[model samples]
Target: MHDESTKQPCCNPPWEPPQVIPAQVRRVNNLIFRKINQFHRENNVDNVTPMHDWIMSYLYWHKNDPVYQRDIEREFSITRSTVTNILQLMERKGYIERQSVPQDARLKRLILTEEGVRVHEKTMLSLHQTDEFVAGLLTEEENAELLRLLNKLRKGLE
Candidate 1:
């Protein structure tokens, strides 16, 4: 017979539930980021990180509109300096080019170069595969609900 009073606890005393939403979200994000980077490395796509891919994808989608560094900064919720450095690197890598608009010479518009388009298209397939892999982990209804909850959380922050 077991001695209830002398039984060892499976976990620490006064165990707390693991309900940290932000930390869980961040961990998942890091996992996805690592997976995408792995895809890039395996595909021989050099000098392109997930951040660079995202910006290039954004520029590609919004090709109809004139996008600037500020637009990227606002969209990604990053600082001007951070965006500037990333843009500079992208330019040097031939993935993007900054052009001065006639209306405001000081305002340089972001445009994806031919190389950017090529790489963006290639990397997008990997991204979509990664997304599908993640989504496949949940049921359709669960995925929908997760999206709704995530949107709610994002709106709360905004």
Candidate 2:
């Protein structure tokens, strides 16, 4: 005999398990993509595709250093030909220039044009906005822990 107090509550339902890690990661990735797209739309940056955006970001990071096609290939895990094709397209679009090194005539250094620098600055601002939005969710300690955990996971996978 069940006591009245112990009887099943009609208002409460059984809890389902939390989403798997991969699903959660995918959802987070989708959110980041959506935020970036929103930023692009708000900035009237419709001409910059995601690939162009990524390349611009990389170039910006190496703006002071001498960057080469092979550096991009190794960093991105993409083929040399793929890097060359993307660089060629970027060059045609007036985003970057390939200049021969006087010290190494065979080497062509990647240099961003004025237009590229402008675009890179804007892109960094948008990314910082997105980063701040996420950073606001956690304390400094939590943020550091999160980064540490993510790096650990990446290293384990690699």
Candidate 3:
């Protein structure tokens, strides 16, 4: 009763239903990351990564507040170790500094150095340009729907 036309070759298995969404999402994520990285590199802002840019922005925005490694870990949903590594690297690159708070000498707050602020501003401009370009590709309604669907997918994984 098997249809010979439906049979897949031995070297390749048929794509299952469950693989579609995740694969597509991953592809989109990778493509966006690469595009942003390339854009940054072209602008001669290649020292910091996309993640570092994000963290720097966070620190910049919350400059008045005391931001710590745990705060970053929570905000980004990344592991403590990963945050530590990224922060350490940023520190080594002179993008940030960990200063002990007055309340507790052991507790260090994350602060962006002057160079970090400059880089963050430069990168933010580049990112804004990229965002505008991507947004131009879709209508307002399509953009809203895309955001809703992306949030739903991310929430489902959470």
Candidate 4:
């Protein structure tokens, strides 16, 4: 009544369960982080500020309508002094200007200079190109589904 196929070694251990999903997510996140950092550095844009920080500051500057320093600080969850420092550097670099609002002398409105506008446009184009390059690997349907699922996940976190 002995079955050789079912027989085990005297010290055989059980198999361990696999952790796949978490590992996959971690790998994907790492890949994205590395690629973005590499791209920014290779472009010589790893200067005064990191790519993400620059992008956020650009966004804040672009939202000129009702632009306020406090709003940017709150939106980005950054310190007031940090925002002030970034704005000052950007201004010094001739990217933006802080003009006194007619209604409020104490509050200054941020405006992008002509050069800043050109840089912002170029930056947007580069971002779009990067997006297309990455998404080109996926089929149209897969891209759509991935976007939808990502939005769902983001909303859930909110």
User: Number of the top candidate by TM-score?
Assistant: 1
Clashing pairs in 2: none
Error of 2 at 16 (Å): 10
Report the CA-based lDDT of candidate 4 relative to the real structure: 0.66
Off by over 4 Å in 3: 1-19
Question: Which candidate's lDDT is highest?
Answer: 1
**Prediction 3 global C-alpha lDDT:** 0.89
TM-score of each: 0.86, 0.73, 0.85, 0.59
- In candidate 2, what are the lDDT values of residues 45-75, reduced to their tens digit? 7566666777888888888999988988887
Per-candidate local distance difference test:
0.89, 0.82, 0.89, 0.66
Error of 1 at 108 (Å): 0.5
lDDT tens readout by residue for model 3, 1-158:
98999787888657875488878888877877777777788777876698999999999999999999999998899999999999999999999999999989888999999999999988887687678877888999999999999999778877
- Higher-scoring candidate on TM-score, 1 or 2: 1
> Residue 103 of candidate 3: its Cα lDDT?
89
Q: Report the Cα lDDT for residue 76, model 4.
A: 64
Task: Show the lowest summed lDDT stretch of 10 residues, model 2.
Answer: 12-21
Tens-place lDDT per residue, model 1, 1-158, is: 87899876887655344556787898899998888877777777745888898999999999999999999999998999999999999999999999999988899999999999999988897788789888999999999999999999998998
Candidates arranged by TM-score, highest first: 1, 3, 2, 4
RMSD of each: 5.7, 7.8, 3.4, 7.6
Q: Kindly provide the TM-score of model 1 when superposed on the true structure, using C-alpha atoms.
A: 0.86
At residue 118, candidate 4 shows an lDDT of 61
Clash pairs (backbone) in predicted model 1? none
